[model samples]
Target: MAEGGTTLEFTPTWVVAVVCSVIVIISLAVERLLHFAGKYLKKKDQKPLFEALQKIKEELMLLGFISLLLTVFQERINKICISENWLRNFMPCKKPSDDKDEGTTAHFQTFFSPPVLPATVGRRLLSEDSSAPTYCSIKGKVPLLSTTALHHLHIFIFVLAVVHVTFCALTILFGSIKIRQWKHWEDSAAQKNYNAEDVLQKKFTHVRDHDFIRNRFHGFGKSVAVLGWGHSFFKQFFGSVTKSDYITLRLGFVMTHCRGNPKFNFHKYMMRALEADFKKVVGISWYLWLFVVIFLLLNVAGWHTYFWIAFIPFTLLLAVGTKLEHIITQLAQEVAEKHVAVEGDLVVQPSDEHFWFNRPKLILFLIHIILFQNSFELAFFFWILVQYGFDSCIMGQVRYIIPRLVIGAFVQFLCSYSTLPLYAIVTQMGSSFKKAIFDQHIQEGLVGWARQAKKNKGLRKAANGNSAGSPPGAAAVQMTKVREEDALLRSQAKGTEIVTDQRSNSSS
Candidate 1:
């Protein structure tokens, strides 16, 4: 941790040392076994208590482990990463350093300023003199974010993730049981109040396509007034941490959307109408795969440290991709509703309004906004790389700068170009989906309207004619009123059924 001193050798021993000192694996196992045995001895009548107890146990166990981890690393990564320079760099408003360390004298507050490495956390850009030596320019202590808006945002995402995961897991467990119950009921197959297939489908579909973000956002918004600062407490408990599993939602969404795409990508017409649907999920898959691959490649290529650091972008791609995919699906679904029928639960989730608007101009505007966001993301990542490069550069540790840049540029070109394949598929998929739905829905509605109009004309004629055996005026009036009501009802029943039907199918 000194200039001109050998770099700190981080090894398994060092890692173990950094981890908690007291390992009580046997005691925890024994306690868990005893708890399980006690539950097994009890009758099933009091399951809710057991369930609640189990949940509490889980939470406590989690808190205990996390507390220990944080305590161990409190003097290392967290303190440094939360340093004033670090937070200010990523999070715009936070102070670079704290006013004073917690419960410390002004004399001793500065006592534990960890010796930072030569480079900062974020990367830099590649320009002229990029190879020039760089050093750890930043100094001083980090301020604890106790706490700020970014903390809230992080907390929000974390809580969202937890609730999302919990909901999903619950759906799977309970839903499977529900399906079996329905199946058992179906075996008897008499006067069944439940449509087993429909109910099952709805249950499964609901599980599959759970809207984690919108639900959490709405949940947060509703509770904001009542909870006051208490909201942050929940956020800290549930949202302060995120795991990669949050991605499982997006992968499912992509697959769900893929079900509706067109069938053929002919050798003759690779970009043909239906062929694009096949590629839509493929595009998303590429990014997901890219993240996995890049992380490993970096690790194997002697930049093992880069794996976790690069995860920020990988995690962003997974998370944001899921968020955006859901947004786009919803927008299309809404558009589907508007085209086929006027009476709709057309409440667009407000957070998604900007990105998921169906209007052409709105989409273009959104595209620009997304581009800017993407650029910022890339720039920040590049800066991270640059910062690392600068760490190596500043430390004068770079072995061969020019060669590294060439290889890096070449790799970036590949990464940047990766979109061509995904874009081709996504564009094809999105457009194909639009076209198919357009033809199947809007066009179908128009044709139905024409057919209905014709049928009404025939009915009117019949009503007016003597063969109907009713007064002409009364017959016409009744027919007209019935037709109007039918039309309205028919209009209200489009995406509502589809969403409901899909949810039922998947969750069941």
Candidate 2:
């Protein structure tokens, strides 16, 4: 060992490589085992099992990838730490230059300053111990991590991976349970021989009685009150007034007016419209928020070594985007419900085509602009991540990367609110949407409306051909009539079955 440097045992490169490889192999083996276990455990409801196993595999794969990167860049990372004078006390055989030492101190001071101050204060204070060896006092080559440290690191990572997998499995399991309950409820209602109107009335009663948002916030407020800052007031406020109450009040007129409308099943429509949204938006948001929490914990624990701090903007954008999307969707659904109530039916009106065609040009222009911005931002963020590794993002002379990222995310948010609207409008114009809407209308006793729309579509096509100097022949008109009769007959048969089922239940 050099002068002033203490002799230290270093983990060999081969040993590090072998350890990393073993970790990766073990992770892969665990993933495979989980796959088989999931298959054996839930052969019928394989979706939830598959989802849990997929998440576990992703977490383990990330761990394995990180371990591989650490092993591959071991020497490079050590050199960087030495040059930056990081972990100097831990690597006493490596000495940083005097100027670099001063720079390092300044760097830490800046790093520990406000915004990050609370998080790093303990580390800074620990570094200031007088008995700690000076940076320049160390001189020889020193491993940034010893064998024991490496083992501890691996164990920590493994534990975290296990915890993450467990959470993922639990979340999926709960979601699956909810799905199963919904299915069971639907089956039970069918077996009870409840007609559509009866089912709708029951659902409407439940919706009217339940204050979902209020109850949720009430519990949350109680949890906050336990923190003891007079948050009982918060709990009381949530208990008194819920957000769902506002929605109920706003739609009260529509609900009352449409209750007696046999042409429209407003309650059934509301339940169907919101059920999928609740599952998709709320479920996805729950998972994302949990991921964000886990990521923040890892950052605070220094597990990512400051590299993943750059991902904060993107992660936050994703979480906020999902939440905003959910809110906007709910608002749109409410507006649509009011419109349907005022119109007194769920029929696709002839005026709808004119309304869409005459939509403000500015709105269309804005849609394109928003879509472009979203696509560009997503593409740019991904490109940066792929092109510039974590070191480059955090420390490797990349100027203004973080600021640019922040700007991009801010711009994305400014335009992201239009995403759902644009998708809705575009899909509304699609054939699939038309088919689904018409089918739904038919089911809701609006078969005449669908028949008229189909007839109008055929007429428009025939008129187009006639305008091109190809007049429709008698045979073509007859064929169109035949097609219409066939569709109407099929719809009537479906309606007959529903009536027969209801009559049989009444008789029994």
lDDT of 1 by residue, 1-508 (tens): 2233222353357656555444556656857885985577345433323444455445446545655664454334333334444432222111224433221111111112222222321111111012323222133444342112122223322332243233323322342332233232222322323332332243322222334333332222435534423432243222221211122222222233433321111111212222222222112123432643443233222233332343343333333333333343443344333343222112222232323343322332322223222332333234434323343221122443333334433322322222222222223223223433232344455566667767767776666674378777888787787588568746655644465346433422
- Residue 7 of model 1 has an lDDT of 27
lDDT of 2 by residue, 217-301 (tens): 2222445534322332233212222234323322332233332322232222323332222222212224443643454334321
lDDT per model, in order? 0.34, 0.37
Off by over 4 Å in 1: 1-304, 307-378, 381-412, 415-432, 436-479, 485-508
| TM-score list, all predictions | 0.22, 0.33
Question: Quick one: best TM-score, which candidate?
Answer: 2
Q: Considering summed lDDT, which 10 consecutive residues are worst modelled in model 2?
A: 107-116
Q: Residue 327 of candidate 1: its Cα lDDT?
A: 40
